[model samples]
Target: MRELELKYGCNPNQKPARIYMDEGELPITVLNGKPGYINFMDALNSWQLVKALKKATGLPAAASFKHVSPAGAALGTPLTEVEKQIYFADGFDTSPIACAYIKARGADRLCSYGDWAALSDVCDEATARFLAMEVSDGIIAPGYTDEALAILKTKKKGNYNVVQIDPNYEPAPIETRHIYGITFQQGYNNFEINESLLDNIVTENKELPEAARHDLLLALLTLKYTQSNSVCYVKNGQTIGVGAGQQSRIHCTRLAGSKADNWMLRQHPKVLGLQFVDNIRRPNRDNAIDVYISDEYEDVLAEGVWQETFKVKPEPLTREEKKAWIAQMHGVSVGSDAFFPFGDNVERARKSGVEYIAQPGGSIRDDNVIETCNKYGIVMAFTGMRLFHH
Candidate 1:
């Protein structure tokens, strides 16, 4: 089929929606539910992200997307015991693709609620079982095993969106879109992120360790698909935080840094030991955990609202305790879609244990940025390639 009609556009009132290819048959086959415009948007963008991640790392990759930006992305890496607990995958028989998706969704559980999932590898029974437990709108992958397809077909009362795309399909070099009756076109962004981009070290601390290089590459590759004015914080093989579509660069850094802090705080011993009522759902637990880690925990306690979420009156994670815990966070890597105009971005990033940075490096305040990185013994690289996605 060359075109597929939709129930509606982004909004319900925006009628007469559909997707089509002018030159040839559409590359995707909808094997399950009918996906709306926004669902397809999320699916296609997220598919590109996972494909790039798998190509760069030579591992199964996955992404959770919302509003056309990735809430989380990850490569298939063995999950530690702690990771399994935090991701709520403790007893599941997780395959590599399952682990990748779990890590991606766990990066920011709050943001990934009702997200669209994408996978670089074909979906298998293990992956489908994991996806069945989550609150998601749809999924896109190259293919799915029979058992996997059967399992996914049962989700959302047989209305879950399952899409299969041809792995060999490639779009034209030039891409075009229309907004408000006007047309816009641009050459596709095909910049490959790899170790070569990390060579231009300008900070006093020029140590880009092998692990840091991998994380830097992960961050940069994520930024390549992220909306403009974006910053991503990554560690190990997954993104911990992503701040996208901000008007100010410093805000992006601060937003992403705070998210990174939250990810770290979740692993705190106090957070790990929190007791909840027997039947609280995962989403509620995530929200309660967020409140527990924030400064408002005392307020929650004072308001007598902790009883609804926790089994006992939990001790507030005091600001001092949070600070002490956060201080131990290290080896984080961060990437920016554009140049930093000031040093404040770096300053904010340092608070979240960011030790390595990558950016396009064309700002007039490059000296100040480097100075701030040096102050914290942080290593930075100027990849000289800006990644601005719409």
Candidate 2:
């Protein structure tokens, strides 16, 4: 079918919504529920992200997307025992793709609520089962196994959006969009992110390890699809934090760095040992944990609100403890859609244990930025390519 009508556009009043191909049949089939305009937007953009990730890493990849930006993305790296526990995936046989989704969603659980999921490989039963347990709006993949499809079809009262795209389908080189009755066109961003782009080390410390190269590649690819003025922090094989659509470059860095700090704090012994009342929902637990880690935990404790989520009055994760915990984070890789204009971005990133960086390197204050990285012994690369997405 060339055209698929939608219930509405981005909003209920934006009527007469649909997606269609101008020349050929559409590449996707809606195997389950009808997806709206925003859902399809998230699905298509997220699909491209995972596709590029798998091609670059030679592993299965997954992404969690919200409002056309990725909340998290990752390759299929094996989960450690601590990772499995923190991600709430304690027991169950899992496949590579399943592990990818788990890590992707776990990167920022609060942001991934009601997210759209995308996978580089076909959906297997294990992956579907894991997806079923999450709070998600829909999913898109090349294909699905029978058991996987059956399980997904049962979610959201059989109204979950399940999209299947042809793996071989490719769009034209030129892409177009419209806003306010005007047309805007551009060549699709086909820039491939790999180790080659990260070879231009400009910092005093020029040592870039193989693992750091992979993480930098992951960060850059994620930023490519992220909204402009964005920064991403990646470690191991997954994105730990992504700050998208910020106006200032420093704000982006600080926002993403704080998120990275939160991701690290979740693994702290204190956070991991928080006792909750029996049968508390995952979302509630997530919110409670977030509050517990923030500075407002003392206020929550004083207000006696902790009784609703935790079994006992938990000790506040003091400011000193959080600082000490974040200091231990290291080898983090950060990528920017554009250049950093000041050294403050570097200062904030270093607090979150960022030791490697990649940016376009066109700012007037490049000397200052490089000097800041040198002081911290951070290795930075000037990719000289801007990756701004809307």
Candidate 3:
């Protein structure tokens, strides 16, 4: 097909929306429901991320996307017992692609609610069964097995968007878009991310473990597709936190660091031990956990409301306890879409247990940033390639 029409644009009021290719037939085929403009936006952007991840790691990959940015992304990695419990991934099919998607969605359950999913490998029955239970809008991949297609067809009362793309289809060298009757064009970003990017280690501490290198590559590739002024924190082949589209670079560091801390805090003993009442909805459970971890636990634990969700009103986790637990988190890797103009970003990242970092490294304050990394004994690299996606 040369074109595919949409019900509406980004919003209901916006009209006359469709996607097409000028030179040839469109590369995607809508296997199921009609996807709106935003759904397609998330699907296409997320597909690129997972595609890069699989190419870099030689493993199945997946992403959970809300809006155009990814909530999380991950490669196929074995999950620990604690991870499965917190993610509610029990009884899952546990295939490689399913594991990747589960870890991606579980990275930030609150943010991933009602997200669009993207997968590197063809959708299998195991992956579809996992997607079936989540609150998601749609999915995109190269293909899907017949059994997987059957399972996905039942999602969202059979209105779920399922898309298949030509894995070999390549876009033109230049891309274009329009805004307010003005047209803009630019060459597509085709710079590759790989282990060689880490060869330019600039920190005094040069100990980049194999696993840390893997994570740093993951972080860089994730930031490549993320919106500009972004930061990504990754560990063990999964993105635990992503701060995208911030105007200030330091804000990106702080925002992504706080999210990384929250990911670690969720694995705390108190959080893992919380007991919820029977029949609690998934979103509600997520909210309860979030409120319980926040400084103001009273919002969810007020005298009359605590009993509604929890079996026993658990004692509030204190700030001291949170800080102590966060300090225990270690070996995290971080990446930035642009240069860090100051050393403050390093300070903020270190607080979230960052030990390795990757960035373009062309700032005037590169010395200060390296000094701060030395103080924390953190390893950092300069890729000499900026990744500023909009």
**lDDT by residue for model 1 (201-311), tens:** 999989888888888888988888888889999999999999999999998998899999999999999999999999888889999999999988898899999989988
> Model 2 over residues 228-314: C-alpha lDDT tens digits?
889999999999999999999888998899889999999999999999999999889989999999999999899999989989899
Which tens-of-lDDT digit does each residue in 1-390 have in candidate 3?
898888999999898999988989998999998999999999999999999989998989999999899899998988889889888888787888989999999999999999999999999998999899889999999999999999999999999999998988877999999999999999988888999999999999999999999999889988988888899999999999999999999999998898899899999999999999999988899988988899889655665688878999898998999999999989999999999999999999999999999999999989999999999999999999999988
Q: Total backbone clashes of model 2?
A: 0
- Residue 18 C-alpha lDDT in model 2: 97
lDDT (C-alpha) at residue 194 in model 3: 94
Number of the predicted model whose lDDT against the real structure is largest: 2
- Can you rank all candidates by lDDT, best first? 2, 1, 3
Candidate 2 residue spans exceeding 4 A from truth: none
Poorest lDDT segment (10 consecutive residues) of candidate 3: 298-307
Cα deviation of 387 in candidate 3 (Å)? Answer: 0.5
